[model samples]
Target: MGCKSCGSGTNEDGTPKGCGSKGACNTSSCNQRSTYDWLSDLGIDDPYAASIVEVSFKNGASKDFYYAPSELEVFTGDNVAVETKNGYNVGRITLSGELVRLQMKKKKVREEKVTESIIRRANTRDMERLAEVRDMERSTLVKARAIARSNHSKMKITDVEFQGDGKKATIYYTCDERVDFRELVRQFSHQFRIKIEMRQIGPRQESARLGGIGSCGRELCCSTWLSDFSSVNTAAARYQNIAINQAKLSGQCGRLKCCLNYELDTYMEALEVFPKKADKLRTEAGLAILIKTDIFKGIMYYTYKENRGLLYPIPVAKVHEILAMNKAGDKPIDLQSNQLVVEEKDDVFGYEDVTGAIELPAEKRRKKRRKKKSGTNAKGRSSGSGRKPASGDSRAKTGEAKTSNTGDKPAAGGETKEGSRSSKRRRGRSNNRNKKRGENASAGPKASSGGGDKPANKPSTPKPTGEGGKGGSSSSGRKKRTPRRKKRGGDAPKGD
Candidate 1:
């Protein structure tokens, strides 16, 4: 028989012997052992060997593969040979029986098609060779891009993954359209001695591969559960009333975000009860267009012609009533005329001419003129009283004559009385008095009336003007006086 991993010789009972190549031979059966045949062949019933539960197909049933009881412990990331319907195909152990069953249920695979038997386990040499292939992937990418650039291809080199056997590497790239990467694959295989596969992806898949947090603060759905990308359009924006210019409404793809459609049905349902702005309504004076409406507020503004053709505001409820009346073929009542505010009329008798007719202007004039005329009359009355009285004039004239008559008489009488009394007293005192004591007389030696007397020496007085003891005016004796008017230098000679 042919070996599953490397196409080499097999043992009897259709079991694979050792594989042919380095990565190819690690999982081969070193000893040919069927299910439940390990302990007996080893010559000891050692209980340390774990019993094999099942063998699982890693890549599914296009290849023939199997694993032995001891190889059941092989996990994912461990390269293993899995038995398929035909030849053995090798894949990493991505899942076991229970998980594979679930995956089968998810993929709806038939129960008989699933392989649940192990062949053998991976050894050290297999792991080391896989690491060698991983180490080669980085350098292979640089050479691949250079090859693509030489061919003038617009394809991008995103990532490279080597198969477990080191026979093939898959290259992921993004391009605007289909790319002919046949030359790139040829160059890669020639340079690296391996098969090459190119995979194309979109911006969303590129974002998922790079891994990012979305605007909603979560891992991208494409990286999580979303394997399919649906087309998002701006129509979703119109349905949700989202402003088309808002950056949040656009996603990293520069298109309307997919989340806008998530709640569109709810908004559409809410919009059903709203009134459209297309309807027209009439008013008493003129027509008004329906501009906008607040649905929740149940209010709308209507414009109608008023003074000077300017539109005035009215409510929607009022417009609806008017529209209803118009539909009923009845003209709307002019509430503006009927509801005019009528002022109460005043009694003519009680109304004191506020308009200030005939006598009013005169009355105002009289009020202004009264102050002047009264002030003039008061000035005239006061001026009449302030005039000197004729009695006062007569008394002033008579008192002037009396003052002239009494002026000499009072002077002569006072002089006669003073002279007579002084002369009589002087005679009486001279007749009754004795000589004063010498000490008393001498105590005031400079007296005028006592016996001891001496005349005080006096300075000569200045002579008076034009009198018995005065002199004729001299240049130095005249008082200095200022002239009343300035003396003119010259005058026009008798008015020319």
Candidate 2:
């Protein structure tokens, strides 16, 4: 018997060692139905002449009740030979003493019904024979499956177990429907030259016999200690608020996970207080649809039809009250108005709201400002505040006047002087308007430039000259006019 659970290798005498007890075999930790014989531990003498013992074969894959003869001294974890259908089979004693009676009652096996008796404590010869049979199981299983497939049997052969004496073999298989394996069994018997017994089991049983790790990262419960499997369905998942995903819900057995039923009763009891048909709550805002439920917290989440992503967590008692009101044909003002409000204290050092303070970098801000300025200019032009100059005739006339007046001045300072005088004129005009409107004089120039309406085009006024003559007066006026012409020409086509 190989203890796959503990990964304990076989001893030199061919018997499995330790039973995965981890030095706790005395505490009855090896088999699934472990029984700590406290009476034997207390040194209490046996009261019965013969006691029923539970012997497990194939590493607890199969177990049977055997009558222990008073003549043979046996204990739990001891290797013993037991009577089978044909010859004797060797197995480990899993249960002994008074606990054996309780285990038999649990399994519904009566004392008189268990006619099989332990033949003897396994000796060296028996251990060697058992090891030989165990070694032949793998090859026999492969050959049996091939024979079944060749015979066109609609069955999956999962495992094969040989008798200790090598005179018999048990073939375990799984099939969705009833399968007649009479011919298949006959082929196995002839090919292997042993008595063949075919056993049909469900997917869960097959997985238990062929044990492996489950999705929970542990050995399969059925293979370890779960001798009985309860019916598991989607209802268990629904009760526990688990998503209905086939791959997640189904276990290695291709059925709903058995663990689903573990907390199902608690979930059922918790949900009983919840209002029935309360999935949709009537409200003045709209029909509030139920999203999900938190059974432990006693909270149900609901969202209105018009508003999404805003879940209102209502207590179970309040939900029932609302449902009762709805039954009486009264609608609540809003779901939130009746919801349970859990006050959360603000953390002084927690993350502050930076939404309003957030600003773009300087380069990005400059770009945005330029974009706004261009858009405003476009709007101003469209609204008739500024019109495109059709031709350069107005510019030519002013340019000629400036050339004649500034002909004597040095070219270096003439442009700068002209620009300064134009700016002064603009400021003067804005200041005069601000005085008339009674507005702040300091803001006038900025207001004129920043406003959607551009400044009105006005003729430049000549500066007073020291030499009071007709030619001097005209030339001074011409100098002022030249700068305006240059400014107008700046907007002309590049070719000009």
Candidate 3:
């Protein structure tokens, strides 16, 4: 089959470029045409050399060219004149002589004989003169712009350069519309007293001339290795699947970066391994279009109606088989016999039965038996050995019943009542005795400590006898009379 990528192009050696990932140019030694080789082509004359150097021209113009011998003659610091169609351009001789051939070939420029020209040596005068030319150029730019403004012109004097000979100064400017700057140039020549040349340049060219490093962290291609610029567009980005962010896509030249075109073929190659998004496929239940792909995982998914229109996953190889069958105008064969099966992988469910047979659930477990109590049982509470209530008395009953039925003290005044009354009478007498004793006890201590109170009666009062008037006059005196004696004897006997 014809190679499945971009159609054939010429190789480096002038052979036909093929379709696969590899595209080589038969003309060059290391003959591949690729991003890396594009850079590699700039350094050496023989196309086989790996490293390449790039060059950029004034006005944001740049190109990739093979390094040749004529370009490598001068050393890094030595000033050398670069041969140009207009004139010999003086610059620090970066690469010279033979290196130019390699740089040129790297750019894929057809080899041409070098122009027989000698870029002359630099001297002290040349250095000083070049500096003077630059100072003059700067000053001239200001005057040039002023002149243009005075003339009601919109042109801006962007740069000025003093010719190597110091005989002429070139003024570089840019304008939206073509400007008649003849008067501006004449005025500048008169002011600086030198020959004046006016040159118009574009924005990219301006950015290239005043170069800066790019986001890629390298010297700008326009200033270094590119010689010509081609119009770059959004399509270059599209082909590489890059987003069209202007700032990112544009280079230091304020134009699309030339590097955008470098890896396009690689991305194109990668896409081949993936399924074409345009082709629609039919499954058992529904029709499905190829919506997306994941090439690395080798996974393809098909949407079908019955499965809630959700995509079902199948391996890429399986999809390829299905595609082949469809392409051959044949129905898909049953894949169960020929299907490639992945081994059972995980313990989504746990351990299998160890006895090699399924076990049944245990029959309803038996209920346990209880031991009965020997005596009267109480309601609500579990009984152990129970005690019976005593008859005629309620205190011996269960704690709750006894508490509820018993009034203050056993009975008020029945038999138990009479006992309570007697107890109360004894308590009353005892209480009175206690009260008297308390008063006597309290008074006795205070009286003894404080001395007893004096009595109301006289101190000499006579003591009374049991049967007589006074003890001193005794019963004998009273017995003087016989009656009195008998009465006394009888009284004495009675006393005994």
Best of the candidates, TM-score: 2
lDDT of 1 by residue, 1-496 (tens): 4533335666564544543222123232221111222223233433443332233222221122233355254533235644433333344443333434444555566656545555556555654665676688788778888888988999988667666567677788888878888877888788877667788877765665555578999765555445346777777777665567767776665556667767777777765655444355544654545544444444444444343333234444565566677678765544342222346878566657656565434343333322211011111321111113234241212122122222323221111111233332332232222112112211111111211122112211223334333212334544212112222554432210
Q: What is the lDDT of candidate 2?
A: 0.67
Quick one: ranking by TM-score, best first? 2, 3, 1
> How far off is residue 375 in model 1, in Å?
74
Worst-scoring 10-residue span by lDDT in model 2: 370-379
lDDT of 1: 0.45
lDDT of 3: 0.47
- Candidate 2: list runs displaced more than 4 Å: 1-50, 346-496
Q: What is the lDDT of residue 208 in candidate 1?
A: 50
Q: lDDT at 214 for candidate 3? A: 87
What TM-score fits each model?
0.39, 0.63, 0.44
Whole-model Cα lDDT per candidate?
A: 0.45, 0.67, 0.47
Q: Which sequence of candidate numbers ranks them by lDDT, best first?
A: 2, 3, 1
Name the TM-score of candidate 2: 0.63
lDDT of 2 by residue, 1-496 (tens): 4443244557665545643232113322255434444444444556773478888887788889898887887876778889888999988776777778878888788788988899998897998898888989999888887888888888999999989899988888999899877777777878999898888899999888887788889888888778788888898898898889999999898998899988888999998988778879888889999998999899999998777879999999989988988899998999878888888878667788897799766563333321211111111321111213234222221222232243433222122111233443444453444334443222222212221133433322233344553212233333211112223445642210
lDDT of 3 at 338: 28
lDDT of 2 at 351: 84
